[model samples]
Target chain A: MIKPTLHSGEFTYPEGTYFQAGYLTQKNAGWRTARPVLDTNACVGCLQCYLHCPDGTILETDDKKVTFDLDFCKGCGICAKVCPKNAIAMTPERGLSQ
Target chain B: MNTRELSKNEYFFGHKACAGCGGSLAVRIALKVLGDRAVAVLPAGCMSAVGFNFPQLAFANNAIISTFAGTASMMTGILAGLNARGEKDFTVVSFAGDGGTADIGIQALSGAIDRNDDILYICYDNEAYMNTGIQKSSLTPYGARTTTTPPGTVSRGNEFRKKDMLEIVRAQGIPYAATASIGYLQDYMNKVEKASKIHGTKYIHVLAPCPTGWGYATDDTVDIAKAAVDCGVWPLREFENGVYSETPARGGDKAEYLRRQTRFSHLTDEEVGAITGGSL
Candidate 1:
């Protein structure tokens, strides 16, 4: 399990130290009803989609090809828009089961 | 051009903003135009929440956190310190939300502009206090229903129109002031590029849409922002050297724009007619 970076306890940092407030875990963005599907056959391993994934959903395989965890992908279409080989396609969640 | 043609290096991304957040996209675009030599001063706003994720900062450039109403003065101090050190190769930008800019930070903003500080102040107007729940703000539109301006039996929504921030910027006799939208990417980017070259207090008010606060689907953020400008609700204009030049109006369907967001859902037919038939 990922340890929480912040807690409800006393302030730990020293004075004059700056800090930001936000959830430590990756937010559940699965409400996006759509996700990106990558065609590995046409994938050029350019890593453009990996660099542009805002939610950090895109992961790299051992073969240097890119894949992403759909659970966190918000389907912003940034990966699709940035794909050089046009290998990534955003498909609706319900339609994927069909 | 899309993100591919803009630039390869990304300065800001992989943060905690909601999906299809126009403010996040605006930060990306602003950083794209400002380039690597820019140091961003973010106030207590959405950008602060998203950009600085604590121990894992998303912004690649040098960024500092400022108090809610202290961004303008902080930027001015940074500029002055850099000038004193003979470091004239960097740019300073203050990115704040509507609440931080139009409401809390306006005093410091006026003072900075009055001093003619060489900095860029970018107000990403999502219309309400979105970070701390949707609350009515001075920049919120007249007919919008924020948490503080909920429609009731005797009341509709906010009865006051948006504060004219561009006019306020112009009143300072600044060198450049403009309004932008993410829908008009090329135009917005062009304006940022131009502002970076100028040497005075430049302000660009971008119409950023909040999906959760505005009660719209995450996917419709860009479309709603575009509709807002095309429907005459938010006119895209630019002021250079005390001259105002409005962009050619693109008459989009106003009814469709209002029907998409729940904040403006309480608007009556007569009120809609009034908005459509009025100067807009």
Candidate 2:
């Protein structure tokens, strides 16, 4: 589904004719059979997992701890693969909860 | 600078690319470099299939889906409009696959590069049209088997040599042109940062290995990508202002790179040797 028309012509440019640049189609799930779980205790704040995550679902805390936003995490295991400390682990995606 | 120490804002997530997808990884890394100031112009390709799946956008930045051949054209128009609006703070990036870059969109790409448009064009070469199944693209190597170029008694995978896209982009005398691989993260990130900052048509051709298309183990994508570069099968090099600087080579065998992927499973020992010997 695309918002083809910009409903209101409030912008400098014409409303409906513009390309629908940012639209979220559907919440895609059922793709990842496994999901990544991060062990914050062992995490050295190296950020390899955060840097290597294909999906930007990993968020850095103010204290430098990282957490996964499972709403969008596709369970790519890239975080686990790139973690030099093996602080991240991939388990079956039964649910977001470990 | 410690490449890993750089903090980045992630722009792509909640997408549908396969596990260990090098293309998606490349986009992630590129977006990290481009940050919030860039708009990505993508055409019909794998990135489109996964990232721009209609309503659910994975990009934190503005991403426009253009026609298969209109990637560069769209970026050009956007940049021009922004320029007219005195928007000098933003960067326009055209991201397309090997099929979109080397085949369908090459004409527009060439024109944009020739004009030296102030945009970055990233060709994430997965070596085939992976979005439409493993069909061979112009950038597919000579001996790899794609769906269209299946090996049999009469044929041995794709027969044509891969297009030298770095040369093609460089031939336009652009400000910067280079080839990077997803396997080497630090190097890839460094190059992406360099390209994003450079003005006037910088082209980065990235070898994004496809597990589905290349018939490789999903976990081995990065390793295989690294092997390709280290083995000199795909040399990591950069062209800046018409000057070429090759990255120092790493020790690895082309045969090892080929042997890991099932796409090259049909090759005999002699065929692999021929490929390594540059005769195939």
Candidate 3:
């Protein structure tokens, strides 16, 4: 019901430009961001994910297990953001998810 | 558990910036990164008059509006004055427009950089003398429109390429040097933070857009800015000592980037290609 508010730390932006306060958006837990999602049946082994995933999220696998690390995903949504097939949508997580 | 999107009035809303003023955005972001411990060394430009024109100074922190050619000189003095009183916690930021930095202020800028002054000199470059109704300046790009470089049947715009200011300063061998854009707010802010931590001269050239000067609709301010970086004409990079670390060479094609502005509208495909190709 209550969305968490970000604490605008001690430092402020004095200059008129974009700047990161040397901090990432999500850093409360040791876990990294969970970024990508996949649709197994629709994949069709086309190597699109292998070719397009900017961070090498999908590797070539003969068995089609197609392992993905949620933490490694920048959630740039490259897979789903550019998915030619209507597959790979990202959803909010609730578990002790990576 | 918390996400209070930064103070509602970081630039202290209602200071009188034009609808699509990139120079105003430059002032906003610079002040935001420096926070309360910041002292702005402003000069005679649109920014000076933007502050409600009277007592309502837009800058919430300690700020000084000085002469046009004295931004760097005064900033050096201000920093020395502050350091003399043992107030080393605050930052002295020298904010000037391209006309100030690339022309009138060049002498003082050289003096300060020569002395290795402890101040951050940010040149919010809008390409020409925008505040003075868009006259030509040394930083104005080739074949771009300005009052002095108006397009005629024979000419597209200014004949000379923009003077290489970053390279000029790099020759001074200061502690830091960088080029940034308001379009890439995060990248600009990160450099401000880095410059804030350093002890000597830091030259940061921010590509501030001027819809009025560039002859564009007020709404295209941010869009134009992003196109600048995405297009390689303004190579984002930094220098410290002899080391050169380019700000990621993110490439954006020329046409989509330069077409909206009236200044570049007259530029032929070949002209745009020549300027944007390796102008960096």
Candidate 4:
């Protein structure tokens, strides 16, 4: 049997939120900017980088190539950090603030 | 989040933390990355007691205080219990100190990873037991000054080299692992964001320098921390799932990184070479 649980707050997050489990998010947890730009020509679809992105920013499209969610990318550079192909890079967005 | 935006984080203002307390700064950004949907499982350490008296919490959400040695396992159980209740969406975070993480808590931390419980296990590594007093921890580097590893008695502060936690966690074959610092705000924020979305155990070994413990100008926290990276004493690298990748070199003057702090006051050319030899 399960007891009735009394949760104090809602577990909802707004769009464009990034780094859901970091010190910056302890309060709002909703900071993001500069989404990952995946070059299909450069991406071989190995998915190694996809498996390790902490933000869930990267996604495998129906076509099987990888993509990313810009609204939630804090631009922490993890994708670029792990991409074996050196296919990923950080693009400084114009006034793209997180 | 960028430093400009980090200033506006919900937990950024009005709380009291010691001057240049890297752990507190780390916790600030760390908890920010964790968002309000998570529960902070803190052990008996600086991270737990930094103004966390009853009714007065720095965190706005659920935070639990557990034993020093079992924070990881306790968080593992917490995550499991939450998952069973359809509460899997909430993040369970274990913020352990270096003393708790690298030494006493390593066993339980390793076990939790082996179990692959979906949790973000973080070590706000200050290199020593700064809370109980500036004693030595396994994460404490060689030739660093601490009360236990006195320069007078031992010549070099910690006789032994700092244990390699990133490699040790990588050995578990868990989903994600990385080394982050308050110095590199964007990188730190991004890594935590990535860890939260991962499916299994993820570990972040953060290098947080304590001003009080490290004996430096309280305001020099960021400058000193940047030194740890620029000097190559602490490489800002990431290990994802099982793949290892070096972070883009922040390449700066090592002297600036060193001269900013007193803990490294004794770090001469020979000592710097030794530390660099191991990390660079």
Task: Point to the candidate with the largest TM-score.
Answer: 2
Local distance difference test, per candidate?
A: 0.79, 0.81, 0.69, 0.69
Report the number of clashing residue pairs per model.
0, 5, 32, 24
The per-residue C-alpha lDDT of model 1 at residue B110 equals: 96
Q: Over 4 Å off in model 2, which ranges?
A: A1-29, A39-41, A62-65, A94-98, B1-8
Tens digit of per-residue lDDT, candidate 1, span B1-280: 3434555445665566887778877887787667778889999988889777665456767788899999999999999899999996788997899999999999999999999999999999999999889998899987889999999877788888899999998987989999999777678888888898899999999999888899987756766777889988788999998788998779987777877899989988888777667643
Give the C-alpha miss distance for residue B208 in model 3, angstroms. Answer: 1.1
Model 2's C-alpha root-mean-square deviation from the true structure amounts to 4.4
Per-residue accuracy of model 2 over B1-280 as CA lDDT, tens digit each? 2445554555676678887788988988887777678889999998988876544556768888899999999999999999999887788987799999999999999999888899999999999999999999999988899889999999999999999999888877889999999888788878878887888998999999988888876666777788889999889989998899998778888888888888899999999999989987
Top DockQ model: 2
lDDT of 4 by residue, B1-280 (tens): 5433432233322223453467766766766667667788889888777635423345555677788899998998888788778875788987899999989988999899899988899899888998888899998877778888887634766788889998898887978999987666578888988899998999998888777787775445555666678767678878876788986656776555655657667777777765655652
Query: For model 2, how does the per-residue alpha-carbon lDDT over A1-98 read when each residue is reduced to its tens digit?
Result: 11111123233433553434443444444566787777888888887676666656677788777887775666667778777788988888775554
- Per-residue lDDT of B155 in model 1: 71
Positional deviation of residue B8's Cα in model 4 after best superposition, in angstroms: 5.1
Candidate 1 has a DockQ of 0.15
Q: Comparing candidate 1 with candidate 4, which one achieves the higher TM-score? A: 1
How does residue A81 of candidate 4 score in lDDT?
A: 48
**Considering DockQ, which of the candidate structures 2 and 3 is the better prediction for this target?**
2
Query: TM-score per candidate, in order?
Result: 0.82, 0.89, 0.70, 0.69
Per-residue CA lDDT of candidate 3, range B88-144, in tens? 589888778898899999899999999998889999999998777899999998788
